[model samples]
Target: MTIRVADELLMFLPAARRGPVSRVPSDGTSTLGHLVESLGVPLPEAGPMTLGGEPADPSTRPDPGAEVRVASVPRPQPVPLEPGQVAPRFVLDVHLGTLARRMRLLGLDTAYHNDMDDPALVVQANEERRVLLTQDRGLLRRRALWFGAYVRGSRPDDQLRDVLDRFAPVLRPWTRCTACNGELVPVDKQEIERDLEAGTRRSYDVYGRCADCGQVYWRGAHGGHLEKIVHEATRQVEAAGVAK
Candidate 1:
């Protein structure tokens, strides 16, 4: 029997059970929903499935020659940011190396390890309730991840913008170590003189210390450049208004 399946729904079956709609076997029967999922699309992304213009669960089996339709779910809107609240934390997979650095520079709570395996990334994200950011589609598809994003661009600046637009976190510039996402603490200039270059010591009197790794920071020649980058990245988000 020839199955006249709807164009909207994609079908999949075990290799032995698979056949073209024009060649659908009389013995083969499966729900429009199951058929769509068998093609690799997640259920969450699939909207209502229908047969003959009536609502049909993916589990509802259809006879051969039945018409099936699968609709897609609408994309979700970005959640509003909470103001006067701590920023949402993130865990980036190994592929987002530059983005992790940029996020840390902007003082977002971000965790990154260049050598993190995919399984470890899933575990960390689930345990910490951290948003998982990755370039891998498989990682985003993990069931344990409540929040995740598939980075759309390869450029660091564009990736930064994509993250900001997706999750508008409260920006607190200069509050984290760009190299290690550690909290920054104010330190006395005289206390860390040996760590400073001669020219840096001669020019700057103020500094901040990283609480976790004891890294020292100062407003050196790079400060202005960093500040500008942070400012530009966060300006639009601030203008959009975060929740208080």
Candidate 2:
């Protein structure tokens, strides 16, 4: 029996499943879908599979000289934010440290650590029901992962845009601790006045305290900068919708 597999699909499959040329399969019979999945590529990774130009389910068996075509997965469609839909949360790999920070600044629930091992990151993502965001292909290959995305861009800004576009989660500004990803609670100006700098005390009145880390936040120079970035990102998202 001879079976044909696409080059991209070959990279994720086990060595035993591939052949020296375009067609290989000396013995045994298996469904094309099962064989592709056995190689570590998820069904979603290979959008639709066809056997001999006919739409075939992954469960369909392959015969000798079967021409199997596995198409690459399409980019995720942007889902409109619904009033009751919960915001998407993320657990980023160590390589995406900057992206995690940006997400936090935007009040997105993002978990990150510069020193966490791969296994620990995966565990945290699963335990917290947070989407796994990574540049590593191996981590995305994990079967236990339910919601994961491969960051296609290299720069932090580009990566952030990629995430926002891909998931289309609701945006809530100034609600999270940028350093620790904890919820921010409103605090009276008098309560945190002593902790503020002399200049900050004279200029800013509004403040929020991080429930977990106890860090104080106010609309200082840094806060203004962060707000500007958030505003710009929001505008871009809105403009994209209008253009469509």
Candidate 3:
């Protein structure tokens, strides 16, 4: 079978296989998604596919001589949801702690643990019905995972952008605990005065505390930097006409 890939996906292919089209001796048994993964492009990073010029799903099996075309996942790609969810929630791998915090800052429900093993992570993803976010292609290839996506870029900021651009989840900034993925609720300053340092107590009046973790938040010196991230993401989603 001949597989044609779009230009955006060229970077994931091996140098010898890097071309507009690749001829693969198909097994005629494996699904198109598996074939694409075998070619080094993770399934989540891939976009829509066409088989013989007809739209096809990843599970479609191709004949040995059929032509297949693949494209990169488009910006503002809708997040896949499980039952009972209004929006996509995420479970991030250990290495993505910073990205997790950033996502939580945007009030996205992000679950993360620094020491969770692959098996554990998969279990959490399945159990919680969260979209697994990871930099590991191997992890993304796991069959048992309910849903997942490959996180592009190295730096946390760039990775955040990649995710935001790929799946424009509704943003509710400052409504979640960056430290613990808990819902943030308004807390009277008097109720948490003992937890704050003297300077913090004097400088900030409005506050929100995590309902689950009890961590407090206020607009402090770093607020501007965080606000910039929020504004940029909001603008991008608005520009793409994604729902708030």
| lDDT winner | 3
Per-candidate local distance difference test = 0.71, 0.74, 0.89
**Model 2 TM-score (2 dp):** 0.75
lDDT of 1 by residue, 157-219 (tens): 889887776567778888898778999999998889987889999998989999999999887
lDDT for residue 112 in candidate 3, whole number 0-100: 95
lDDT of 3 by residue, 110-163 (tens): 999999999999999999888899988889888898788888899998999888
Kindly give the stretch of ten consecutive residues in candidate 2 with the minimal lDDT sum. 73-82
* All candidates in order of TM-score, best leading: 3, 2, 1
List residue ranges in candidate 2 displaced over 4 A: 1-45, 53-64, 68-85, 239-244
Off by over 4 Å in 1: 1-85, 242-244
Report the C-alpha lDDT of model 2 over 26-99, residue by residue, as the tens digit: 23467776666655665545667787889888778888767777765543443233366567678999899888
